[model samples]
Target: MTDPADMIVPLLREMRAENLEQHEQTRALVRALDKRLGGVEDAQKSYRQALTADTLLSKLVTGEFEERIEALENKVRELEGHK
Candidate 1:
């Protein structure tokens, strides 16, 4: 006759191993998503800064637009922080 406790031990060990493997896989997927999100955020920030600079330059050709551009840029930066 089989010892029931001995039989159960191997089954439990296998289950624990499988659970650990699944947990590791999930952690890896979350890390990858985090990296991609960070890249997207950085790109967005760069684009906004470039746009602000361009607007300021265009206004420069006309004369005395710094105050308005500065205010707009400040608002954009504030919004970016919220994101």
Candidate 2:
């Protein structure tokens, strides 16, 4: 009969090889996930920049409209005083 310890060596070698292969696959998956996460982060930054620009433009336009309305109201008050 074959020695049991001699058989165990080959089995251990096979398990070690399989474990190495699985470790490489896990590393590849993590790299792919990291790449995808970078893309998502870039998109979020672009969206945030666009939102900030839009908010600034809205505030400026609103300020100009308010100024024009105030001027018109002052003119109406001046005309009433003349009458």
Candidate 3:
């Protein structure tokens, strides 16, 4: 009968190689997912900032509702001068 150790050696080496290949493929997939998630997170942050900036700009434009704000300020100044 053939030596059992000799018969098992080749089988063990093949299994090790397959395991290594699977491990490398899994690592690659994880890296790809990480990169995609990073991009999504960055995009979300940028969009939030842009929306905040838009809201601030809208408030600034609309907060100054009347064109007579300067006249109102001058009238207040005149009243303060009398006091």
Per-residue C-alpha lDDT of model 3 across residues 16-73, encoded as one tens digit per residue: 9999999999999999999999999999999999999999999888777654687798
Task: Assess each prediction's global lDDT (C-alpha) against the native.
Answer: 0.93, 0.99, 0.93
In TM-score terms, which candidate is top? 2
Return the TM-score for each candidate structure.
0.65, 0.90, 0.68
What is candidate 2's lDDT per residue for 4-58, written digit by digit as tens? 9999989999999999999999999999999999999999999999999999999
Worst 10 residues of 2 by lDDT: 2-11
Look at candidate 3 and give me any clashing residue pairs: none
lDDT, candidate 3, equals 0.93
Clashing pairs in 1: none
- Positional deviation of 12 in candidate 3, in angstroms? 1.3
Residue 43 of candidate 3: its Cα lDDT?
A: 100
Quote the lDDT for 52 in model 3: 100
Residue 8, model 1: lDDT of 97
For candidate 2, list the clashing residue pairs, or say none: none
What TM-score should be assigned to candidate 1?
Answer: 0.65
Q: Which candidate is the best by lDDT?
A: 2
RMSD per model, one decimal: 16.2, 1.1, 4.2
In model 3, the number of clashes is: 0
